[model samples]
Target: MTSAPPTTEPWAAPHARGPVQAAVSLPGSKSLTNRALVLAALAEGPSVVRRALRSRDTLLMAGALTALGARVETATDDWTVEPAPLVGGGSVDCGLAGTVTRFVPPVAGLADGPVAFDGDPGMRTRPVGEVLTALRALGVRIDGDRLPFTVHGTGSLRGGRVVLDASGSSQFVSALLLAGARFEEGLDLLHDGKALPSQPHIDMTVAMLRGHGVEVDDGEPARWRVAPGPILAVDQSIEPDLSNAAAFLALAATTGGRVTVRDWPAQTTQAGDAIRDLLGRMGCSVLRDELGLTVTGSDRIKGIDVDLHEVGELTPVVAALCALADGPSYLRGIAHIRGHETDRIAALATELRGLGADVTELADGLELRPATLHGGLFRSYADHRMAHAAAVLGSAVEGVRVDDVAATSKTFPDFPAVWSALLDAR
Candidate 1:
C-alpha cells in the first residue's frame, strides 16, 4: 500500500534479442511469508521468519498484523514477530492482496475491538463473503459480507462446526483454520459445494499449523478440524517463490534460451511448483542440479492442453507463452481466476487479442491459437501477475509497451530490474 506513485507513461519492455542465460535468485514466497506472519502473530512467543519476501502485499500483511497488536521487527528479509495481545478498534488496508483480505479476519476475530477491513477499489469485487458469513456461523460478531467490512471482536470466537462452499477460493478455509486453534471450542470446517481451487495452499496452512504444534485433522476430503491448543513459535526459512519463477522460465521457453532459478526446493506444497511440469510440457528442457533448477527452451515452443486449476496464479504467464506457441492451447480448470486481482481470463484474452493472437474465452479457461504477434501497448490491469505476463511477451515481441510497470511490486518489487539483469547476462 506504500508503493510509489505510478508513471503516466507506459514502459517500453526490453526485448530479448537472443538466448538469455542467467542464474536468477528470487525472493521468498509471498504465500509462505504472509502465512508465517499470521501464525507468528498468534503463536505462544516470538518467532523469526528468515528471508521473507518484502513486497507490497507482504508489507500490507505486516502492517495489518501491527494494527491488530503484533510487534513485527524487520531487517532486510528477516522478520522477528513478537506476539502481543490481540486488540481491536483499528483499520486494515487489504490492498488488493488476497492473503490480506482472506487471512486477516480470523485473526481479527480474536481481538477486543472493531477491526475495519477495506482494500483497493478492485478488492471490492474479490470474494470475502464466505469467510465473513462463516465467522458469523461460528458465533463471531461480523458486519458486512465483503471487503469494506468490519469484524466486531469480543476477545474470543465461539468456534465449532461450520459448513460453507469454498469453491470460489481456498483462502476461506485456510483463513478460518489459521486461527481455529485459538477459538474457544476450536473449529470444524467442512466444504459442502464444488471442489476447492489451490488445494496446496490449504495444505500449506495445515502444515504450518502442525509445525506450530496445533493439531489439525485434514485426513478427510473437504473437512478440516483444528483442536483448541497453544500455537508454538518457531524459527523458519521460506522457499523461493516458484510462481514468479514461472515468468522468468517462460522467457527461456519463448526465446530458446536457458534460465536457472536458484534455491528451487526439491519438494514443496507451493502451487507454483507445478510450473516445472507446465513448462516441460511446453517443450522446455527442465533439470535440477547443484546449480539449482534450469530450464532450456526448445527450438520451437509447442502448445499445450492443460488444467491449471490448482496453480491458477501461473495462468497469465502460461497464457502469454501459449500466445507465442506453434499451435493451439487449451488452458482449463481456472474459472476461479476471474475473481483474482482482476478478471485475469478476460484481461489475458483481451491483451492477447490486441497483440494479434487468436484467443477465445471459455467459461473455465481460454483456447489460444498461435498468430503472428505485433507490438502493442499491454496494460497490467494493476495485477502483478498480469505485469509479469506482459514482460514475458515483451521479451519476444518488439515494441511491446507495458503500462503501470510499478504494479509488479505487489509481490516481486524488483521484477523489472531482475528481468533486465537476466537479459543482460546474455
Candidate 2:
C-alpha cells in the first residue's frame, strides 16, 4: 500500500508528559457491527444493531448490503437492517474493508443479476480469491478472481461440501457461512491448507449464526457445516471494541500509569480480548471490576516472546510495546497479517526501525530489541493499526508524528480526538 502523499501534513501524535491516567470508552466493535449487518441482510425479518460503529469499514459494509437490496438505516448510532429480495445489476464499492470486499459477494450470489465489485487500491492486493473460487465451486458465476470482478447471479447457489485453503484469512470461511443458510444444500466447508488464521473470527461467525437460528456444526477443526434454513433477524448489541482499547491501555503500560476502559466485556468472542493477557505478560497489572477492565503499567516494560496466530490484529500496538521494553521481544505466528489493510509486518518493521528501534522482520512476525527511540514520522501506509502503533510510541518517544492518522477512520470515527482527549487536549 502507498503512503500518503508528501504534501499531506502529518498528525503530531500527543506525547505523554507523565503517567497517563484516564477512563476511556471506545466505540462499538467494527467486526461485530459488520457481521451483524451481513446477518441482518440475510435474515428472515428486520434487525436492529445497537451501538454500531459508524466508521469507514462499517459504513462500507452497510453501503454494500444496501447496494445488494438490503435497506440499512444508519442515521443514528443504532442501525436498522431490512432484508429484501437480492436484485442484480448493481455496482458495489468495497472501499478498504475486507469484510465488504469479501463478505458481500457470497450473499450477492443469491441475487438474480450481475453485481460488479471493486475497492480501494490496497484492497486489490488483499487475499479475496478464496471467496470467489469457493463461490464458483458452489455453483455461482464469478468473472474474476480479484477485485474489479463481477459476480453474475442467477438467483440461487448450489452450496454443498467444498474444500479450500483458508490459511490466508478467516474471512473467506465466514463469508460463505454468513450467507449459507439460504443455500439449497447449505454449506459444508473444510479448510485444506495450513493452519487457519483468525479462528476466533470464524467462531464468532458460527456463534452469531447459531444465535440467529442457523444450524452450524463446528465441532471439527477448520470444518463448518451450515444447514439450509431461514436466518432469524435478531437484535444485536455491539460490545465496545476491545481491540481499539489497545492504544489507550498501551498509554498506561508505556507511561506506568493506570487506565480503565469502560464497559469492557466480561466474556467476548472477539480475538482482541487477547490483549489483556498480552499486556499482563508484558509487565502490566490487569484487573476486572464493575467499573471495567483496568490496566496499570509497570515501571519496567518487560519484553516478551509469543505467537499471535489467533490475535493477529494486536500485532501493531504490541510491536510498539515491545520496542520500548527494557529487553528483547519476539512476536510470531502472524504471517497472515501481511495480507491485511497493508503489509503490517513490513510497515511495522520499517517505521519502528526509522524511529530508532532494533527490529528484525521475519516472514511470520517481528523481533524487537530495546533501543533509544527518538522522534520520526511513522508512515501508516493507509492502515489503521499501523497508526495505532505510532500513537503508542509517541507516548514515550517524543516527536513521533504519524503520516495519515486519518487511516484510523477505518475503525474509529475520530481517533485523534479520542487519543488527544486522554491527554486532555482538544
Choose the strongest candidate by TM-score.
2
What are the per-residue Cα lDDT tens digits for candidate 2 across 272-387?
99999999999999998889999999789999999999999999999999999999999999999999998899999999999999999999999999899999999998899999
Runs off by more than 4 Å, candidate 1: 1-8
Name the lDDT value of residue 394 in candidate 2: 92
lDDT of each: 0.91, 0.92
List model 1 lDDT by residue over 282-336, tens digit each: 9999998876789999888889999998999999999999999999999999999
Lowest lDDT sum, 10 consecutive residues, model 1, at 1-10
| Per-model TM-score on C-alpha atoms | 0.98, 0.98
Clash counts per candidate, in order, are 0, 1
What is candidate 2's local distance difference test score? Answer: 0.92
